[model samples]
Target: MKYSIISILLSLITLFFSIKINLETLIDYLSTDGKSQAFHGLIELKYLYKYYFLILSFLSSLFLVFAFKINELKPFKHSAAFILILGIVSVFTAFWKWFI
Candidate 1:
């Protein structure tokens, strides 16, 4: 249950950062659409998600550790359990996008 809450918080934080990065990327892309520069804006965008990958992977690993040691979320618990699954899915989905 705690892991689920933590996961949701982390995921939300990541999402907020993701939106900011995306906006920056969009601006960069538009600003450089016609003019040629020494550094390509798209290149910057390409590597921007690396930090998120590291963050989410580290978080997921930490969740696994604590889940096994302390959480032990049961599948049938319903309320918190459902929240936990939702949190996990959101984290994994964001992580997956950053992954590839």
Candidate 2:
């Protein structure tokens, strides 16, 4: 319960930052002949991080819903299980990145 709340809170924080980041700077980075390639590359990396964070956050919300509906085992249970597993795997993948 507490972990879910903290996860949601952190996901929301990441989402907020993700939405605020500018995409044009990232687009510019992908342009091979751009003047600010180095700086723009850094910005692009941040942009990707922001987007992945947002995706993870989104997935986390789905996992929360799955967790909430875990007991029913009627209609949403299968979906919930699938989502729950997916969430676990995703978090593991994210952890690997963090650790490495």
Give lDDT per model, in order.
Answer: 0.51, 0.48
- Candidate 1 lDDT tens digits, 7-78: 545555655555555555545555664564346544564645536544753584466456556746654223
Backbone clashes in model 2, listed as residue pairs: none
Model 2 CA lDDT for position 97 = 21
**Runs of candidate 2 exceeding 4 Å displacement:** 23-46, 70-100
Query: TM-score for all predictions?
Result: 0.49, 0.33
Model 1 spans > 4 angstroms off = 37-53, 68-100
Residue pairs in clash, model 1: none
Local distance difference test, candidate 2: 0.48
> Which 10 consecutive residues of model 2 have the lowest summed lDDT?
91-100
**Cα-based lDDT at residue 53, candidate 2:** 59
